[model samples]
Target: MADASNFIWYELMTGDPAGAARFYGAVVGWTIADTGEQTAGGVDYRMIGRSDGGNAGGVLALNAEMIAGGARPIWIGYLHVADVDAAVEAIKADGGAVQMPAMDIPVGRIAMVTDPQGAPFYVMDPIPPEGGGESDVFSVTEAQRVRWNELATSDPEAAIAFYKKHFGWGQEGEMDMSPLGAYRFLQRGEVMIGAVMPLMEGYPVPVWNFYIGVDDIDRARDAVTANGGTITSEPMEIPGGEYAMNAIDPQGAPVGFVGPRK
Candidate 1:
């Protein structure tokens, strides 16, 4: 079984799925395939498949109802839990709002939620694989895969408290950005999956940003700009001799990319 608080899935909710497919394919070298699957509400969903034959994430088209209700293109992560109902209850008790009630799906039960500072994400109890094989969904060390998750929120300390209450995350380490305060790294067990920090001034509500891995940061950054995506930040080096950038895809969904310069 996977760890209680590990992020097991990533998804994109976009206004234009086809446009997103083309842009991400160029930027991240992904092959977007039609899963021929629908949500419990019957909306069309697409799959983001990695080159290594492992599934990376999912994409679903925003429908009329969602658009009318002010839905926009965005990427969200799904945190796996052992029990959907209990997780939802704990989330509410810890100052989170349930955007979607717990419900059954083909693969698992899921509930959409927002933390106290309003960072939205999914909590799911996935159905175990048949014949007992592990699902290789995430790989921080693999190129062309989701390598990191980040939460830029209004209050990192309070957000950490709420998450710890429900998901059992602990503060593993932190980086001091004097002007911006601290970048706190969070871990579920031994694996360092992501970090949380204060949302920069003038940014909208709290949101999670996922970093997809690439073989070469420079090449991928160029691909992003060449493919109609806007590079919000130029490539910058991190602790592991890797570089990363933040960007907004053509459809306006924000995403990040990480890897080396070569």
Candidate 2:
């Protein structure tokens, strides 16, 4: 219960759930935690999480209603923030839309928002920060959170404005990428929390993709498909010789795990 780095929880909203559970088990080294029911957004939800009996995150049975006006499937990240209300106010003042207003949950107040470019994500005051909802709060290990925060949007200028206003997350440095204005990395203080990049032509929607850390990429990729998951990208090397793969769970929710290179 130290940092947001562990990404303590994860959730999938998918079309084929049973298959997703099986796929994730293979791709991710996790076992089944629990499956339960809930009613929200006009559809029922199936809770999915880390097999380690931890709050890895959850999965929901997606329906036409859940998608925007019945749009395609999307995965949203929930980041733990220190203060929910202040965060919400900053997001609003910075031109971001609050899709779901702040509401108190068993853990603490949670709010759903679209960064200036419309990438959907939720911000919450975790139980530990709010007191005993999860584990006690401590600036513990700089645990490696597989799903680190990053946003992809058509309008990154506005996007940066939104986060800086809300969470005080501002640009760290920009790396020149020829045609694509430099790629911008963001920071929460000195910690690398997320990034912002221009949306590619024809690939329109602005969204956030979660990144998971693993020890092996090729093996993780095979495990994903073998376990019933679908691979969107094959094992590839990222900078520094690190390798990774991207895929969609059996439920069609985008997922990726990163590992050290050979």
lDDT of each: 0.86, 0.64
Against the true structure, candidate 2 reaches a TM-score of 0.78
Candidate 1: tens digits of C-alpha lDDT, residues 1-262: 2344778888899978888888888888888864437766898898888887878889988988998988889998898889988888878887889998999999999999989899999999889878766456667798867888889999998998887777888787899988998999988677888899888853588999989988899999889989899999889999989999999999999899999888
Worst 10 residues of 1 by lDDT: 1-10
User: What is the per-residue lDDT of model 2 for residues 1-262, given as tens digits with 9 covering 90 to 100?
Assistant: 1233222344566765666667666666554434546544344455544444544556666666666555455566776777778878877776678888998765567888877777887878776643345431111221123535556788888778666655566587877767877678877566665578887653368888777765567777778777767777778776667776768776556766777754
Off by over 4 Å in 2: 1-9, 37-53, 67-72, 82-86, 129-147, 201-203
Q: Which residue pairs collide, candidate 1?
A: none
lDDT of residue 95 for candidate 2: 68
Predicted structure with the largest TM-score when compared to the true one: 1
Q: Which stretches of candidate 1 lie over 4 Å from their true place?
A: 1-3, 34-36
Candidate 1 residue-wise lDDT at 222: 87
